[model samples]
Target: MSGLNIISNTSLTMFILIGIPGLEDANFWIAFLLCFVYLMAILGNCTIVFIIKMESSLHEPMYFFLAMLAALDILLVNSVIPKMLGIFWFDAREISFNACLVQMFCIHSISAMESTILVAMAFDRYVAICNPLRHKSILTSSIVAKIGLVAVIRGAAIMAPLPCLIKRLPYCRATVLSHSYCLHQDVMNFSCADISVNIIYGLIIIISAMGLDSLLIFLSYFLILRAVLRLSWEVRLKAFSTCISHICVVLIFYIPFIGLAMVHRFGKRSSPIIAIVMANVYLLVPPVLNPMVYGIKTKQIRQSIMKAFHRNATRPELFH
Candidate 1:
């Protein structure tokens, strides 16, 4: 049959996720390890949320943005890892077309939300550091709420159309995906139809989401540094101290993401597993690390965590 005929005639109802090719013997171990990572991410983020909510001291803009970031990290990881572990542990790889669409949308949109939240957090830090006295007046509760809402809405608005655009194409190629999740690029590779529009739109979204946010974040830090440099040595340390965790998170997010993009575009001859692992790391590491970084670096969070543990430890003895 001609390629054109196949493109015109073929239709698919589902796709099979081929999780980690050529490692069938180690699937169980991989799943076990991934489960641990997922658990850590969930517990850490949830603890951040709980402590922030319980402590009125954390009601400020910086902490509120941190809480939003933790929540976004949870959403981003949960969107992919549950299905991923299922594929590895049970060989449950089949995902219906609509389900795949929903998964793709959620994964990308949550990631976009994360990027925007990071930018928001960076702006918060800039305001706090560069204009300390005006920080409260600038990032009021209403403004913070609006930032969160815009992050979510921007992600949804940009990513919601991607799956639908891909859905309209004819997927005559192999239904097996490279990784354990429904990524936009991976799914697009299976379509036999003309995907120029889809590819262009995907590029546009990436630039608008990650590229733009990353640039703005860097700009915010640059301005913050200029302001911090003029302060006393002790004051400089105090100012930069508040920014360390956020800078760590930004590195954690962007480094792996940039590596993944490089691997995807230029590593065609490289091991497929390299691309897959990088992709997983890009999504998994930030969520898991953000809360830990915050909890350790931010004194209030550590004290709150200790207090929670002490209360829990004493409760059983009191009851007994």
Candidate 2:
């Protein structure tokens, strides 16, 4: 209460993200690695989007959802990593309170959107494999558009109030955040004001958005597996091949997320660097791995990429 009064008297205008504690001297090295990762993620996802757009053969429901996922990855990581690179490379760690809220909203909203998109993709796979005859009829372009709209609405509606809730709190400490981004819990931890409401809202958002989406994704796969079991071995294998890339991307996205959650809940006494690293990995790994997974695992995407390259190479020869 006394802390609340003090914080109220002294309003907070900015926060300093404590990026990679105990690695002060090694920031440049870390930034170099981070820069490489950012480049890979941006380039890889954009390449997927471009190929999907260019190749008419890829104009299907699954690739439609994939393009959305790629776009989400670009927006999600772009929301945090550039400024993070700024902190690591140039010592630009100060973030205004208003900007911090906006960043928090973007990160959380895009994350929720990504989870939703994953679920939509799982449904797409389910319809394609289990009810191949009805796939196109069910997942028509309009239906896909509606799914995208629902994903956007779900993410935006759930995460919209979080920043406002955090803003209402009075921050008593130095306004320092653990990670290099303005995560909801990280920012909330700085507040001297009562945070029961903030915590509750955050839990609601997680359960409603990510938790529910993950469960639905698993259930979809369960149904998919059951459907596959009834088919001949060769057909089962072929059906399963289409799922390998999605499963890999899911693991890449969720494993680090679970690790970060575990560390936050149980690793209170552990080194801060562990949490920071987990946060970084959670944000960085999926975008970098997704395009690689899809490009390598899915024949269509690989062919499209090679076809585009071949077309580009031949245009010059034709001119000659």
Candidate 3:
């Protein structure tokens, strides 16, 4: 069959989402587990944001960036997990083309923002540790707010063209997506039209946006390390400890992210299960763990959480 004929014949109005390949029989179990994780992620991230906002002590740039991270985690998981539950539990597997594009935009653009936030957090740490006296002067509330605005604008600019690019393509192959959500790579893979430009643009965005962010983060940490080594032994330990949570969060996000990227770009012959697992790990685990890490490792956040819980417990119920 000619490509044009195939394109004309196939209905690409809606894409089918198969939640987790090879786990169709265990969808009930999967749905339950996913739901639990989703709730925990939402609760944890919300608490973090709420605490950071309510506590005047956490008005510093570091906490400011941390709050941004928590909020992004909420958005990141929300874009996928609810729909996933609908697929697994309700068997609502269909997503309209426009809806799929929106999902793809949310997933990728929010991911880019998360990376930028991480880099900003790294810079916050760098300034705090390396230039303690200048930290306050350098990263004022105005500067941090500007950074947040830049993250949003940059993410939107980079991902804005992707949906249009994919929309212009003619999808002639199977419309069934690889995961519970739509991904640009998966959606474009089914297109009958030549997607070399799309593929190239995608790579450019990844390399220029996320890749550059990674480099800046690494450089910030390197400077931080150098500055710490020059400090007293106890002070050195304190500086390293301050960065532990951010480091853990970064690893949590980037490790699975890299795995999924590799699976998409290079693992065409790899198992569908591998891709799906990587995608889930990349999207879900960070949201679940980021707040937990910050809550346990950052003393102020922990105290705020305890205070909130105690306050709620001490309050009388209106039903009484």
Q: Please provide TM-scores, in order, for all candidate models, with all chains considered together.
A: 0.95, 0.96, 0.95
lDDT of 3 by residue, 1-320 (tens): 45344453225678899977777889988899999999999999998899999989888899999899889889988889999999999899999888999999999999999999999999989988988899999999999999999998888889999998988888764778888898888888888778999999989987998889889999999999888888899999999999999999989988898899999999999889999999999999999999999999998889988998888887877558
Question: Lowest-scoring 10 consecutive residues by lDDT in candidate 1?
Answer: 1-10
Cα lDDT tens digits for candidate 2, 9-109: 23777889866888899998999999999999999999999999989999998999999999999998789889999999999999988989999999889
**Candidate-wise lDDT, in order:** 0.88, 0.88, 0.90
Candidate 2 minimal-lDDT segment of 10 residues:
1-10
Cα miss at 220, model 1 (Å)? 0.6
State which candidate has the highest lDDT: 3
Of the pair 1 and 2, which is ahead by TM-score? 2
Q: Give the backbone clash total of model 3.
A: 0
lDDT of 2 at 237: 95
Query: Sorted on lDDT, highest at the top, how do the candidates line up?
Result: 3, 2, 1
Better-scoring candidate (lDDT), 1 or 3:
3
Error of 3 at 30 (Å): 1.0
RMSD of each candidate?
1.8, 1.5, 2.1
274: Cα error in model 1, Å: 1.4
Among all candidates shown, the one with the greatest TM-score: 2
